[model samples]
Target: MRHSLPGGTLVLHPDELHDGEAGTEAGFRYRMIYVEPVVIQQILGGKPLPFIPTGLSTDPRLGLVLETFMQSIDAPLERLEEEDALFDLAQALDAVGNKRRGRRAYDYQAAERARDYIHASNGASITLDELEYVSGRDRWSLSRDFRALYGTSPYRYITLRRLDLARKMLLGGFNLVDAAMAAGFFDQSHMNRHFMRCYGLSPARWLSMLGRQTCTIVQE
Candidate 1:
């Protein structure tokens, strides 16, 4: 479903196929917070994932909670304060989910197998066809089931894993080029694009911000 959310709107988007476009000529600015399905499951104590019917809201209370959560991330707050902010956001989501809760069954085992194969790859290249073959499910079914179970598509999941590896290698003193290549990117430029998209900054900028030294090649 296509949505054109306005400013100050709170969106409760599910792990489903959806896209957005600019609503007006001036463009729009929004802050997004992505919560993993497992985190929500833990919050709900194993309740089936909740589905928000409309997915768009202008609720001021939810908006305030989201703002607080975002602020807590950047602020030098105590660990308990951060936890309290997170719980507030989770509870807000749970309240919405309770309003229109529903569930759909999918091939859990097949999805699990695909997830396991991706984990075993460890920054190696992966393809949907390979996932299908390993999981004994068709590409479309596997993709749907995987998203249902993991809150992201398979290729996106792979990219996230690669990003994780690249971050670790960078912290371990690997240079940008080596870390990018070793983490399954084509080169530094390729990794830079994804790093910017996912983390809102380039790898070099991120490293410098963290005050981590580079190019030392620490022994693993």
Candidate 2:
């Protein structure tokens, strides 16, 4: 979707199939935060997620709420501060958004249980049957609830969690193959594909950027 999103325009639930391209020969630049859905659910307190339509938004409240969040991409936000900002963001989205109602009630507790299971089983191959058993919900409902509440399916969540471990391992100076195995991935290429999809960069490039960021922080 071609949108002339100004600096303060907010886009929500960006799960659609799309690609970014420069509109003009002069290249463009922008900043984005890839927050997980679980973070939003934590602050929303069992409320259904707000769906802000894709494209430009001129809502003043959203712009103000996003200012602090969008401005501090490079700097780290403390836990409390980040939580507050996310809360404001979710509230603003709800204020200007249409409610997305579904027939099935979203079982937040069940999804949370599944999420805990995923984290606990990090670096291991977990099956949907196991999640079903642990969460006490059927496979389809559990998967739907997971995506609605966490913004991803159980399998993807597992993959992302493993990728998180792989990222930490890599940052700690582990070799690529070793890190992949340690993170429960079958091989380096398999890990590389998921890493690129999640991070928009290869492991090597991500590591290089982290090194540069570290040097910049030290110099500052």
Candidate 3:
């Protein structure tokens, strides 16, 4: 978001789809953080977050904090260290308080409810209107609030959730086909397309490497 987002916000997996813009400005200044959901789960040691903190803004101070935490994630991190990253995040959120002004309470609540529903039905093909109905929100208001609260739209969230599940299945010794099914992808091809963009490798190759790692650990 354009307004200074309060710190301590945790954007969920990349598959989750988030956007950034300057608040209340013409021509919207834009920025985005691109990282894989697998990276986030890796950071969290392969655990799924039913919910992760997020929807922060880009302030100068937040910029520094974000850059530093990002630097530490040279590789997908383990779950234990996620707390370490969160420690730094807590400091940032304390700096930015809740309650974004010029935004209505109903609007904010509707967006949050919609996102929460998406999180609940991750990987399912839920329509935008469905999301709004469950959230007691209209499409236009939900769209804007969804962006502000979760940094992504209903459609994007479903896709990312699918991809995130796929990554987890891969790490769990599921083959490419299984991973795709598990993640709610239509097929290996579908999983492959998203995987290539997010992880820079084919699902088969990723599964192979993961398998080898598991084997090595078992041997040890």
The worst-scoring run of ten residues by lDDT in candidate 2 lies at 211-220
Candidate 1 root-mean-square deviation in Å = 12.5
**TM-scores, all models, native as reference:** 0.52, 0.50, 0.45
Alpha-carbon local distance difference test for all models: 0.71, 0.71, 0.56
* 1-220 per-residue lDDT for model 2 (tens digits): 6566455564756485556877789877877777787656654556766776664577888788786677567544433235446656776776777655446688999999989988998778777667789999865567667878988566667778889999898878788888888898877767887799788988878888777321111112
What is the clash count of model 2? 0
Clashes of each: 0, 0, 12
Worst 10 residues of 3 by lDDT: 211-220
Local error of candidate 2 at residue 34 (angstroms): 35
Model 3, 1-220: lDDT tens per residue?
3244334334444366765555555544323344444444442334453232345444455566465346444534323223334433433443443422343454776777777787787676676557668989655456546656776545556667888887777677766676677676766766676688667987667767756432211112
For candidate 2, the TM-score is: 0.50
Give the top-scoring candidate (TM-score). Answer: 1
Error of 3 at 116 (Å): 1.6
Give per-model CA RMSD: 12.5, 12.5, 15.9
